[model samples]
Target: MAASNSIAENIAGSPNHKMLHGTLQAAGLVERLGGDGEYTVFAPTDAAFVQIPPVTREGWMLPAQKQVLHAILNHHVVPGRIDSAELERLVDAGDGAAILKTLDGRDLWIRRSGASYILTSGSGNKAVITEADLAQKNGVVHIVDAVLIPAT
Candidate 1:
């Protein structure tokens, strides 16, 4: 990906975004998150959101849920770009564990298991990085298989 494209643009340009673009835009977070400096967004695809319980996802889409949506999205972002190699090094220096501060003002624990990287939220919810090192202008995105929910 080129540095000119923001994380949202990169995702929107992706084939996967076709289905979720409207939802993201409707939520009013597209513009704020899109076209900014480089950022690594652990974006959840439409399918991933589908995996969420229907009622839960519905509740989150409500106008009152804006804060929650922002929190969830921000949880997926870290201030600076952190690639897998640097993450690995950090984990190694920390004895296979490191803490990543999210944009949501929460701490996410990163751990290395063999060759894989696992992210654990303060609530103990964990998600593994299924795809890493997706370079974007603002930062790098590491695709995760599951969503991480912070403790309420």
Candidate 2:
């Protein structure tokens, strides 16, 4: 599973995250994410990306949109490793919901949805944690079903 690799390395090697890997490269965030620091990335899979409107998706890839893309990517990352177990504890402590501060200086609310969990953005966009807790050398990655759009 190459659990010893950094978050960016693992994402780059993952077949399901090809689009995300490329986007990170375009956003110039690969180096920082791969460096020595604890991070939790709610990575959207290739399939999840397909759900976005083609034109909207393509626009984000433009050179002029690099900073915008970076913000979108940063919205998915947290400062520390908040694995599923820890998320559960936090949710319980918050009386069924917890506000996690994202690396982009925004908040992401996590709530229990039956047996699984879901993250709701400030804009009200919801992304279910499809796959959780893929450990890496510096942190972990969780695959989400949808792109989490942060509030403007």
Candidate 3:
């Protein structure tokens, strides 16, 4: 396989990355996570943001809403590079499913649906992997269709 690019590079190269990267930076997670090591981020595309209630999105971006923003962002990330194949193997070895712990101290469940991978968080919200295997230096990024929100 070819070498993976850095998150910064990927953000710079992709139009979708621009807004996502900016949001992460504004939340102050970019620097801390940038140098930590590999991470697997379940990146929600701009289109995914549309799925969120408009007021919720506006609230998260507010300066006074930093804590909420951080939690939401962290909820989308796993500390290591958990590629799709590895995720499949893990699920298959554990009763056809497995629970992945997130950086935010929440559990994300992984399961298979025929050939597709499904991820679910505590509130029973599900996000399908619209695009997988975009490798980055700090980790891997899987683009999803919906935003993963933590239970309130």
lDDT computed for candidate 3: 0.78
Q: Write the per-residue lDDT of candidate 1 for residues 1-152, one digit (tens) a residue.
A: 45567777777787755434554665666775575655556665666666778898777778898788667767777877789898988899999899888876798899988888888877787788888888877778787766677777
Model 2 per-residue lDDT tens digits across residues 34-64: 9988999999999989998999889999999
For candidate 3, the clash count comes to: 3
lDDT (0 to 1) per candidate: 0.74, 0.91, 0.78
* Candidate 2 ranges beyond 4 A from true positions: none
Q: TM-scores across all candidates?
A: 0.87, 0.97, 0.89
Over all chains combined, what TM-score does candidate 1 have? 0.87
Q: Which residue ranges in model 3 land beyond 4 Å of their true spot?
A: 1-4
Error of 3 at 145 (Å): 0.8
How many Å off is the CA of 1 in candidate 3?
14
RMSD of each candidate relative to the true structure: 2.1, 0.8, 2.2
**Rank order (by TM-score, best first):** 2, 3, 1
Give the least accurate 10-residue stretch of model 2, judged by summed lDDT.
Answer: 1-10
